[model samples]
Target: MPTLSESRSRLLVSEAGIPVSNWETADSTQEAVSLAKNLGFPVVVKLCGDEIAHKTERGLVRLNLKTEDAVEEAADELLSSVTADDGEVTLLVSEQIRGNRELIVGLVRDEQFGPCVMLGIGGILAEAVADVAFRLAPLSRSEASDLIDDLSMQSLLDSFRGEPAVDREALINVLCALGDLGSDQEVLSVDLNPLIVANGVPIAVDALVETVEG
Candidate 1:
């Protein structure tokens, strides 16, 4: 399966009614700086391309840029880092989002079971913690809510460290949207990691979508 670029992945989920952080693409450092200014201070810049997956692992992502200079520098460096193997690359500038909690949501096609929706505790140690729940696609509102209850780290869903509790309805919609997206024959999988609970609303800050073709 070929993974869509971060921008494309975010667009795919957003079109499915999944919430995502505000972002824009720029072809040049100046354009990136302009977009960052429009998005307010403390932005994130990334080198995005259809062929360039695992950006963080490749050091193509620059986060917490608080000024135009920082955005410009990061954008320039990111653009310069691209190689022929990266196919085509563009600068993605988005608002910097923060939260005390993170969750993961996704869809997968099981060879036998077909499509399944997943919910999990996310962040840097997602795999280490391994707290997750899964259900067959085309879920009901009630079934989607059950997936939330299935997670072992229940406390994470509650108000913590002065942050509000996770917005259950919004999350349910995200899961339900993934379920709907799963039914699409061309979409192989969808991964939304570190769905930041900003002011209690789950907003996907990073996403990756696997599709059958470009």
Candidate 2:
């Protein structure tokens, strides 16, 4: 597998037919403000440099910001919040996505399975419910069975009484792709938590990826 050894290039997550906000790479303070006007309405700003991870935890990400002035202010604030140990920082300003729920899809390498996939109810309640399931890579229909039979979180996927049910099949597709990634790509780490499934469909709201070391 070809390892992601370059620090200058960022991973691009483009999917055909999926409606996502266009993200602009802001190289400077003035450029950030100019990009915001074109991005329109409410937006989110974050440090996209290789040196930064845990942006939310570090207070390096700002949300629900509207207007060029707020963007500029937030941009400066985000830049100053964390020091760039990697020398320079690249920033991203994107349109904000609105939703109430959060779901997680991720991968963890297992010695036996090589690369395993994980899915669960995300956010604060995930811990309480322990709503998570795992499956081995190169998943087929039979492998998806583990998610239904072995995982303790199946109840969350259903609709009882007045509640609505999520698109279960769509979730399964994500798992299949993760399995493919583990087998085909040298994926060290990935966090697609809180994928923002709404009205029975899933879209990645926030994500993080790291290259695996051989």
- What's the number of clashes in each of the models? 0, 1
Best by TM-score: 1
Clashing pairs in 1: none
Candidate 2 segments exceeding 4 Å error: 1-21, 125-129, 145-164
TM-scores of all predicted structures: 0.98, 0.78
For all candidates in order, the CA lDDT equals: 0.93, 0.64
Q: What's model 1's lDDT at 196? A: 93
lDDT of 1 by residue, 43-85 (tens): 9999999998898899998999998898988988898888989
Give the Cα error of residue 17 in candidate 2, in Å.
9.7
Which 10 consecutive positions of candidate 1 have the poorest summed lDDT? 72-81
lDDT for model 2 comes to 0.64
Model 2 over residues 44-71: C-alpha lDDT tens digits?
A: 8877765555666677777888888898
